[model samples]
Target: MNGRWAVGLVAGSGTPSERIAAELRRRIVAGELALGARVPSTRRITREWGVAMATATKVLNRLRDEGLVRAVPGVGTVVAGKPAPAAGRSREPQRVSPRASQRMAERMPEQAPEPASRREARPEAESTGARRVRAGGERDLTRERIVATALRVADQEGLTALSMRRVATDLGVATMSLYRHVPGKDDLLRLMMDVAFGEQPLPEPPASDWREGLETVARVQWRIYRRHPWLASTMSFTRPVLAPDAALHTERSIAVLAGRGLSWEEMAQASVALAAFVCGLAVHFEREAQAEQDSGLSAEEWMDRVEGEDHERLTADPERFPMFDAMNRGPEIDLGLEALFEFGMARMLDGIGLLIEQRGGEGGGLARGSANK
Candidate 1:
């Protein structure tokens, strides 16, 4: 927010975020940064300060916690007001003109002091508790709001980065206040999972044939998993999470196979198989994203590093592993996840088709396998 020239110089030492935060605090205290003035956005801070997004977000969040900057729903993070003049800083109270006060008032809710009893009774805020509570004041805490915020955090920052404290920080509420709506992390996750699935219900399959219908259903699931990469990792095949919206996927899958001559076991097996395949591949999406965040290298960049290695080059040598060597020379070597998904899907459908045909499309205890075999 300072100026455009600071973009590339993001390098720093011991906790640069803290340094940036201190500087902003100073600016707010001085009146050089006016009350109700728009502050730098996290993205602007990241690019301008040469810091990571997390660092930038931390900067804003720290200011919010101190009641220096407040989130204005449709607007954004803005300077809350000059901090109360501290000792040695100034003797008099910082004055605000009526117009400036009104604008600032519109941007922020009035703050209320925490009740003495509750303040003394509360336990220390831990990392898990950090994301959930907003400091005392402003109102508007609801379970729906909390879960939605949690989902947003998971969607944008990955699930590992999501916590009650993080969500509360974004909501501009005390972390402890979130517990009033959602019980705990496990409960939050259950709510988040249900919301994610329920929010995007699968529409009825429009294909004429059963195989096409199955493909349609499977692709819908695949797309949903792709949209929320963290999703695939959270799911389990056995002892499922008991989410009703999520269960709709299986219901739809089975409904598509109605009158397809498949037995109950066959239908269930097919649904599980398709789900397993989609989820197995989709797990890589979150893993790859986490790898990028941790390593600061993209999937292509990491793979390029591998492919440039001696072992990788050795695998392509014609003298050894001839088929791999031959395959490496052409476009067929493409390893796009989408291509792999479709390839696996086609094969699974082919086997299912063969089962239907071999059993004469009905009867013969098809679910029990062929009598001759």
Candidate 2:
């Protein structure tokens, strides 16, 4: 396998199933398996590879995990196309700063034309009572208010339920009026993510410990996902939201690690890993919560069904699979999801700590390799 795919797979390796998963991923990325081609069925893979059914299932899941393949209901698993580049990739849409606006106008003189239309200003209405003296008129709706209301709706319902019409109805305004605030769904979602990031209470730097600082940030992010379950589904790593608050959080995270003496490359990798860990955990948590709500079955009850099958499998093979037998004997696995998150986060931080120490010994500066710094 190429180094890139090898590294990708190694990062996720922990079990035999995971190792098989890694190999499958390596194959897919290396183009050993073509795009749009169907992956081998579980039975075919099991017979061909001489692995168990569970292992084959895990392999397929791993491909799905990396977004390599997707199931088409009755059609089975087929490879997914690589995503196209985002429309805004080339020209980053910046907030209209005075300097930027001036530069644009200079470049395109036609855009500097006089204002073409005007709305008739409303005449001031006569005030009526003591209440009018005490209170101001209804606050004019702004972009912030529009985004806040949209976020609230997304929090209560999933992102799938959020729409321009729905938000307009909630705000007691005509649907066309919303266009004056937010142009479309994409614009609203971007603003909502920005507002959500703004809600986090970031600590002032030089944090006591880098790990602790990161953990705090991750926990705050977890809280956001817990409150707004749709967030996990909406967030995109490839097309990051460039809102000021979101950018500030990224800046803070990098600053926390700078104290550790890590190089720019190391810090960048660490940042990506930290984000993936939090997002991955949140996705699973949201999925489990949704499953419970949909089925009305507690987590324990769901585990019981899997445990029963595991028990039956153990009875059939006590000698051939000693590891499986031992696992069965151990305390019921809660998937160790919470513990896994902490453990993985700590391990990643520990690796960064070691790198920091190495860089410190070499008398290297934190900003030496970073572009943003």
Candidate 3:
């Protein structure tokens, strides 16, 4: 890795991440950036290097992967101890002494707590209670790490269990420190939603068949909701999260319907309808997860305990509900969410197909004759 960095730097040619990582690496090895001192954060890196957030994230990730730096909750990313002396180099720079390192760390400016009056002036800031400093001395913390940790917490524990304190506890940082990067829980949730939606990217050149494209979009959302069961609850149909990546899903849906012999209104409704169906069905996922967690029983087990009594009650009046009794006696139905999602998606697409056909049949020489061809 050192050899690669040397060559890349000397040649002045490499990916943005490589060049940036090399620069940071040089600072760490030279002891220009002292051990345990906070390194430039992702935001700082973006500002200093003028790189995109994605590229900045990659640079930090590469540094992390190489073990040159580590993220300290509340403090941000800092140099991970001092780099070891290179082998067989008599001229190698001497490692900074512990005393000198301590002095350097002390010389680094600390971030004082924000004043209460100042915090109160921010309209969106919610009171997260009195802040507590981390037990251990401050380590480096970063917004990227905070968001990633918050995402994990939401995924495992569900959103209701999430809070600024919850994330701070998980990060081993003071609750107030998070406010520096994320203003409040609302902003944190938005960042989490953005990261989640950006996980899957749209296909280049897109699918030629509108049906295929729409199906792809629906399935992608289903998979995303399945992975983050709590994601469905965060979404709003009317007042959606201001996440650009999430909006791309809607764009893709509408793009496929372009020139499909439908009015602008019809196209817009079709896109929204597809999203509504997916979100409506997906709500069950988080609810079921929470139910299982709280009740300590899987859906099947919960149903098993109740089904016997319910079945008997319904079957007792067999003549009144003959078909219901017979069907229950026959095969066990797969009413699982995954099964329902598939059934709903197929049926929804069928409805959309009918709408397209109906629009084609309307008077005034067809809205777009190309749809039939």
Candidate 4:
């Protein structure tokens, strides 16, 4: 406990309560405090650490704030299970095989130079084929190839670098050839979004449970946006493309929620709310991903920069933002999408749950009246 407390103490410094909270946070992250382990009570922590009750409260609050602890009805604050690891971090590192290394060596360029005659002849041979193709190549280009090349370019350099000319050049075709496939940039974008969204497998209609169905659709959409970071901005809420795959997803979502006894209006409103939550989250995540890709800054690095800027702003105008200053004094405030989504989802579900219960009670009362009649 002393060694652990020492590590915690060193990590905790700055604000008295924050230091205490940090130490506790370290324990949780370090796996020293296993998930579901009962953290010491406020009074016990105060006495054990020789800190005030206020300090202990702050420490617990910080842990709860970070989703590391939960308070059950009868149980005091208890540690929460570790959140699922971020995508792609849980897998083992891929190792190249010895056979692949041997294959690579076999394909390596020769060190010796080719004969002068062969070198001179190679260009002539290639030029003959190029000239023949140039005369007859106009008819060989197709819409599929253009779209396929455009997708490849987007996959490599991102959607921002994609253009008709770029796709045509990649395919060794004229830019006008692409017009047969896509009318313009906007048309290409619509087609591209449809293609990407189509990649998401729609769940079977009439899911066994509403929550399971909603979660499935939400997770699928989330993964799509995660892979295609540009999809968030490209997708339109008001005028979503009525692609078959997209329509199937919408149909499945509605079918699942149909059993909830909600009126058509209520069901539609709830569906919109859920979709908005998922889209908002995807947009936020994509923005962060793009920022990281462009700036080469990790999340922690971005947080550091933000905190530094906030500190400077606070010092420059203490009188203007008293509440912000007070909040800044506490643990690092994370107003990230993860937190926002969790808060919104919990409240939204709670409201829905209450509605369902009330509907059930009303239905039950009507049943009793009918039985009496």
Among all candidates shown, the one with the greatest TM-score: 1
Cα lDDT tens digits for candidate 4, 53-82: 667666765554345654332223455534
How do all models score by TM-score? 0.61, 0.56, 0.60, 0.54
Model 3 gets an lDDT of 0.70
Instruction: Give the Cα error of residue 195 in candidate 2, in Å.
Output: 1.6
Give the worst 10-residue stretch by lDDT in candidate 2: 129-138
Query: What 10-residue stretch in candidate 3 is worst by lDDT?
Result: 361-370
Off by over 4 Å in 1: 1-138, 205-208, 310-312, 316-320, 362-373
Q: Write the per-residue lDDT of candidate 1 for residues 122-154, one digit (tens) a residue.
A: 333354424334345327778888888887767
Model 4 worst lDDT run, 10 consecutive residues: 123-132
**Candidate 3 residue 53 C-alpha distance from true site, Å:** 36
lDDT of 3 at 322: 95
Best first by TM-score, ranked: 1, 3, 2, 4
Q: Tell me how far the alpha carbon of residue 65 in candidate 2 is from the true structure, in angstroms, after superposition.
A: 38
Q: After superposition, how far is residue 269 of candidate 4 from its true place, in Å?
A: 2.3
lDDT (tens digit, per residue) of candidate 3 on 1-373: 2555444453577787778887888888777876766677665566566667667666765564344565542345666544446676332123445675566457643322223463333222123423345455136678888899888767754665467865775565778778888999999999998898889777778787777788899988888887888888888888877899999999999888888788888878888889889988998888876566445457889999999898988888999989879988898889898898877877777678778877773221222332342
- In model 4, the clashing pairs are 12-19
Give the whole-model CA lDDT for all candidates, comma-separated: 0.68, 0.59, 0.70, 0.59
Q: How accurate is candidate 2 locally (lDDT)?
A: 0.59
Q: Which segments of candidate 2 are over 4 A away from where they belong?
A: 1-140, 319-321, 361-373
